[model samples]
Target: MAKATTTIEKRVPTQAEQEAEALQEVMSAVAKNKDALLTFLDVLGELHESGALDMAHGALKSRHQIGVIGMNQLNKSGAQNMIKNGMNTMQFLAQLDPNKLQTMLGAVASGVDNAVQPDAERPQKKPGLFDLFKQMRDPQVTSSIGMMLNFLRGMGAAKGRE
Candidate 1:
């Protein structure tokens, strides 16, 4: 019969030995990721060659000055209005039905394309009142006029609210 051991003895490595173990692990990792390490070094080399690294270092060193300049620019009235207008436009767009907007934009594009044709290709004579009345009687033209009226109604309602 064999006697079983009841206690475990753990050996704590010395600082130098621990450092050596860490170095070995790092070396193995470097060897395992040789291609990635090389690619990273290549990117770093490119940045250095392009003077981007130097610019970044300088920017970091003078971060306070850069921040002040940025703040001053942003404080300008034009910058403020630009930011405000952009936000308002984004908000307005977000509120619209995407499908309807897309359709309307496509219609507008086609209208522009039709309007820009060479004079020889299009009717040289401006539509007479009778011709315009005939066009208004067309189903497509009637539908567009209805859409424009609805848009005007919405604008009127918005104005009332304001």
Candidate 2:
């Protein structure tokens, strides 16, 4: 019978060898993304040439001053008022029916467009009070008046609550 032999191997890499392995991986990645790296470098070079990079560096250096200026501006009464108004407007808009608002905005936009672009087919004439009263007979006009009346009633109720 032939005798069988088993071989065992154990190897630990040195620090330099491990570093070299990391460098090899980095080199492989650089090679794979060579085109992208080159493009990025080209853009950076252009920015540097245009002095944008310098301006950016200067801005970064004066970040504290920029922040102070911004804070000072925001601290002004006008800025505070603008912010308050914007918040009020946002709150009001949030409470509104989006569908109705959208429809109203669409109608307003269409009306503006029609006003800007006059129709050649229709004879333009200033509507008289009698003509307006005659239009009140229209169902569309009646519905709009009804909506306005309800809106006025709501405003009255709100004023009462206030």
Candidate 3:
């Protein structure tokens, strides 16, 4: 009987080999696109210097439209996970230093203020009590309120026993 030989092929890449291959691919692409990429960056810088970029973006409704486009690509679960991850990451980053935490808080406050500010210095309309009650008619809102009430009641009962 003839002896049978089995050859096992290794499929996993070593970390160093993977890193070298990634670096090679990136360098190759950079070499190929260098001129066009430089030209694009120059044009972007010029636009920024001229204040034309912001005006163009505003005229094209780019910010809100791009946000909507990006949001549409996310499923509910993906968005929820992204939000959870972002909050967790922010908390971790904030804990890094006191200065970092203060900076982040300031940025958040500025963002909130900007969002609440009206366009062209106009005052925004405050919703009436009826309008607020109308929002409560939403099933999701009502369910969330019910859950919150139950939690509060449970806390109150616990306190009573103490």
Candidate 4:
């Protein structure tokens, strides 16, 4: 008789596991480059306020690089609590110089205003009554309207029966 073979299946990680892994990577990175990490955060804060970050979305998407670099540095420095202390330092800096935070806030507000404001040269479209009526003639829209009308008619008939 031939020996029966048994196969073992590996379980895939769930969403929570993946998220935890990502968080671990970020924490490890933050712990490694205490000084450089602080500088990078400062730059990020400035860029975020200036709206430059939006333009750099493609480049900034590589958070893994930042994390790995930070982790490698932290591993070298052997500072396990770098991330915790860094947070404290950031809070202290913000408190110590309120003017800096105010300036950053002002920049962020201006950036938001600039982004939301429409350009004068861009032509604005105003839909006419005919345009609205034309949409009602579309097959999908007509079908949807028909369904709604049927529902309303059913409701009215039900009320009349009562």
Q: Give the alpha carbon lDDT tens digit for every residue of 10-64 in model 1.
A: 9999999999999999999999999999999999999999999999999999999
Q: Model 2, 79: alpha-carbon shift in Å? A: 1.5
Per-residue lDDT of 16-35 in model 3, one digit per residue for the tens?
99999999999999899999
Ranking by lDDT: 1, 2, 3, 4
TM-score winner, 1 or 4: 1
Q: For residues 19-76, what per-residue lDDT tens digits would candidate 4 score against the true structure?
A: 9999999999888978998998999999999988876885579778878987888887
User: How high is the lDDT of residue 79 in model 2?
Assistant: 100
Q: Compare the candidates by TM-score and give the number of the best one.
A: 1
Report the lDDT tens digits of candidate 2 across residue range 1-162. 977768767799999999999999999999999999999999999999999999999999999999999999999879989999999999999999999989878867876887788579755789899988997997966976887798799999999998
For all candidates in order, the CA lDDT equals 0.92, 0.90, 0.81, 0.79
Give, for candidate 1, the lowest lDDT window spanning 10 residues.
115-124
Candidate 3 vs candidate 4: which has greater TM-score? 3
Which run of 10 residues does model 3 get worst, by summed lDDT? 114-123
Maximum-lDDT candidate: 1
